[model samples]
Target: MKRVAILGGGPAGAFAAEQLASAGWQAVLFDEKLAWEKPCGGGLTYKAYSHYPFLLENSTPKRFVTETVLAAPRAGAVSLQLDQPLLIYSRFDLNRLLLDRAERAGAQIEQARVLEITRQGSRWRVLTNHGSADADFCIVATGARNPLREVGTQLTACDTMSALGYYVPGEQSMIDIQFLPRLEGYIWIFPRCSHLSVGICGKGEPAGALRKRLEQYMTEREIPWKHGSFYSHLLPSLHTASWRRNRVTGEGWLAVGDAAGLVDPITGEGLYYAIRSADLAVRALLSEVTGLAEKMNLYQRLLRRDFAGDLEFGSRLARRVFHGRFLWASVPARMVQFTRSSPRFSAIMRDLFAGRQSYLDLRQRLLKNLNGSLYEMWMSLGFRRLVPRKAA
Candidate 1:
């Protein structure tokens, strides 16, 4: 039987294993912890649920979420009450679901840290703490690099975007995204059944900075939720410039998910992109006619075509909105009013939230609005001039 080795037990690796197993390939998965809880906001957008049905249909902890309350740090907070429901589950629960599915699909689950990986002739050898294993193909699914750095790969680390996540005792079912005035990151409150998952990310420079920001946000909001009980992780942004070198695949091995730097820069959402990329990897592996290197290149091309514009656009917009306290406090109201009134404006916000649309989508909408509503644009321009400009 043809064998495929997948590293990491995160969404990407598990998804890849499930995909490959469905394709009749024997998949072996490795990770340090099988039920380890990784730090994430634990909120999935509506589009994410639509894309991954298994999240709701066959997952542990069950799916719970339907509304999102978006708030900006500014005085005139623009609120977007989403009509569609979102998916919110524990990362531990979700990971277990995906991993279980992969295992059921015939992927062997192994809990071991990968020490190193090397190419051996036509096959790939993976060195793990448990021992070494060889496979016809290897997939690097490691969420983030640890001590083991793959050869011919540039392991570039960015300033870690720290996040604090934990479940609080509460009675709520909606998700909240609060833009904090003093911090670069916003506070998130996602409730599931009986407990509230609240935390904050960004703005915290050092490791412990997130805790301080969370304390201030909770205290200022008069929220009675206690702190000192939460999980934190470094949310790494994708190194956009290194996509080519990252090469989703090599001679006999490939990479997926955060291993391939597939995280969406703006939203810190990786499940969608991770699964999407894994699908591409499975396609390459399954196509008997395609060479592995060619398949790798194809995955890169698909990523560029599938998500390039949206990622870049989101990053640029995030910088504008998240760079300073001023815009965080004021811009949301302006955007909410415009979005609610104009279908064209709504499309722009949709593009921003869901990566399906391009940056040009917003640009086109703005230009169209400018052509038809010169007075509205002029008023916006006037308001911009009225505000004290500060560096974002």
Candidate 2:
């Protein structure tokens, strides 16, 4: 049997191992820290659960949130009732769940840090701290902070964003998204099973500045983040140009998840992409193409045909969505107001939150509904103006 060396036992690596092993391939996964917590909100959208029902059917501890509050400067706040609830899981729990599934599928799991990966003719030689392993192929699922420089997407300062936050001790039913005045990112408060993941992520900003902004927001809202555990990490938010040249696959190996920079630039969503990319990679490797170079090319084509193109478009729109002005207000502010006053726009926002909406067609949808949305907003304002005032 052909052996495959899978690096990084996160969602992508674990899922790939599970699929490959189930298909009768010899799969071995390596990771020093197999399961751990991350700073970002670990929420899976409807698109994820619908594609992979096991994610929701599992016995892992998770939270289902059906409500979200979106707030923006000068636009106040608007409450959105999600038609499809979000599945929130602690990163550690989620990682453990995937790893368990992989192990049960006959994958050999190793708890050792990968020191280096060298190509040996047509095979691979993986050197770990504990020992070395030889495999016919390699799968790089290492995250954004990948230590192996020879593999995965080469990320520059502009291709990443700083994500930092605290796991606050609290409980809530709804999710909170706060958009700042001039920042290229936003703040999120996602309610997990036991605690809240309150964090901020921004591009072209230092982690220290993002942390200060998050702390200020927490203080203003009386969230008591001082007593919470702090965490920070980098998220892949590749530029449009970077996507065209993204290094996903090469000879005898392929990269998956954050290592390949398969993340939603606008929303910072990676779980779905990670799982989806892993599935695609396995499919490509298992295809009857026979040629190694052909399999690598097939994987690239599958990714672009599936979701990479959409994410590339999103990267182009990220700046405008966060900082662009619309009708004398910021784009985020207008988005909040539109969602509050227009049912048409609210439906769009709901779909976007559920991951059912694609960025490639967002502009078309917005332009098509602009006139009707504006009329609805005007009518809402008129009705509010006609309401009787209380005693002043």
Please list the C-alpha lDDT of all candidates, in the order they appear: 0.67, 0.95
TM-score of each: 0.83, 0.99
Candidate 2 whole-model C-alpha lDDT, 0 to 1 = 0.95
lDDT of 2 at 66: 97
Q: Give me the candidate number with maximum lDDT.
A: 2
The most accurate candidate by TM-score is 2
lDDT of 1 by residue, 1-392 (tens): 38988888888889999998977889999989986667765666656667777665762664455445566543333444454556677778878888988999989999999888888788888889989999888888886554546532344555236667666677665666776555556778877654677787773366576677777777786666674357776665544455444545566777777676666665677777778778887876676645767776776676677774466455556555565333233555445455434445555565555444555465566776754444654566577789858989
Candidate 2 accuracy as TM-score: 0.99
Tell me the tens digit of each residue's lDDT in model 2 across 1-392.
Answer: 39999999989999999999999999999999998885569999999999999999989999999999999999999999999999999999999999999999999999999999999888899999998999999999999999999999999899999998999899999999999988999999999998999999999889998988999999999997989999999999999999999988887889999999999999999999999999999999999998989999999999999999999999999999999998988999999999999999999999999999999999999999999999999999998889856769
Worst 10 residues of 1 by lDDT: 324-333
Checking candidate 1 for backbone clashes, the offending pairs are 66-85, 74-329
